[model samples]
Target: MRPWTLIVVSALVLAGCTTTTSGLMARSNDTEVKVNNRNLGRDLSLSGLNRAMVGGRLQARAELTSKASGDLYLQYRFVFFDATGKALESATDGWQQLNLAGGERRQISALALTGEAVEFEVAVRRIVDE
Candidate 1:
């Protein structure tokens, strides 16, 4: 191969190796929870955000761990979004309760109610007792 042809081939190979977040598989594994009503960071942590297409519908999973010494009660919900970041219409996006013991880790999964949801964001907060 010519030197210029070799250089172009090398460049193409390097480009293929580069990681790109332009696709649906590229997701944010955010561990921080910002809540105005309570300090969730002190007692609970979020991680392992994953997304996949199951049965032609988007599915998301998140790992939640309890950092407190005692048991903690929390509520979580999945907010779906399209490729343009617009919220998708879903009746199943409701607050679900979670109970975690100290040093316990739980993986929660939710299936998108609509096929338009290509992405998701998880919102978690402490369950306030009245």
Candidate 2:
């Protein structure tokens, strides 16, 4: 094998050793929750998403719980969409950090930045310590 081939193979192996977990997504219009990461699905639970129009803007609230026995560090972000399903915000809403105690349940809420936002999805992910 050539030296270039050996280097490429080593890089591929290193990349394969790393694991990437996508955030869990829950849609306001859907009852089913989408789990992108199985590990996080086992540790965290997200449900009871409710949305209401307040002062001509959309407000959303949801229940978040930590099933783990220890403290769980996590992050969440809300993506708002219009009636046609087009995203209103350019996904610029940054991830907000959250910490939950063992078996703790909390109500998380977010208000749509724009009144045109008619639908929404919330994504939650674990904060991996490197």
Candidate 3:
């Protein structure tokens, strides 16, 4: 194995690992949202978030609004975190789908499966068809 060949192989592997996933990300403390898709980002927005502790679990209600004049098909998922900002659950059942009518506002809520969750992040993405 040559040194240059090894370096090139390592670079390729590192590049592949750094690939980013595009979506809309919102946190409990931030009013600003990160949108990775231009069309979806422009039409959809996160309006508000309400959090509470219920039954020893973290409960979150996220308000989503559509500014577009047409309906939007989207999916969203809630990621739970503990006081240290470590994710509490993974391998979720996949994103939950929803429909937002033009100029419509809706609230979606989720309860954490574990009591250790004290923080949460919401990820919303457009549903794409093959």
Could you tell me how far off, in angstroms, the CA of residue 62 lies in candidate 3 after the best superposition?
0.8
Which residue ranges in model 1 land beyond 4 Å of their true spot?
1-38
lDDT of each: 0.74, 0.87, 0.84
TM-score of every prediction relative to native: 0.70, 0.82, 0.79
lDDT of 1 by residue, 1-130 (tens): 6999999999999998974222112134454444444356666767788889988888888888888899988877777888888888655577788899999999988887778888887777777778
- Model 2 lDDT, residue 3, Cα: 98
- Cα displacement (angstroms), candidate 3, residue 1, comes to 22
Q: Return the lDDT, model 3, position 34.
A: 81
Note the residue pairs that clash in candidate 3: none
Write the number of the candidate with greater lDDT, choosing between 1 and 3.
3
- Give model 1's TM-score versus the native structure: 0.70
Residue 31 Cα positional deviation in candidate 2, in Å, after optimal superposition: 0.8
Over 4 Å off, model 2? 1-21, 90-92
By TM-score rank, best first, the candidates go 2, 3, 1
Model 3 TM-score relative to the real fold: 0.79
- Can you list the residue pairs that collide in candidate 2? none
Best by lDDT: 2
Instruction: Give the Å shift of residue 77 in candidate 3.
Output: 0.3
Candidate 3 local lDDT, 1-130, one digit each (tens): 6999999999999987973446688888677788888878889887578799888888887999998999989999888889998888733536899999999999988888889988888888888786
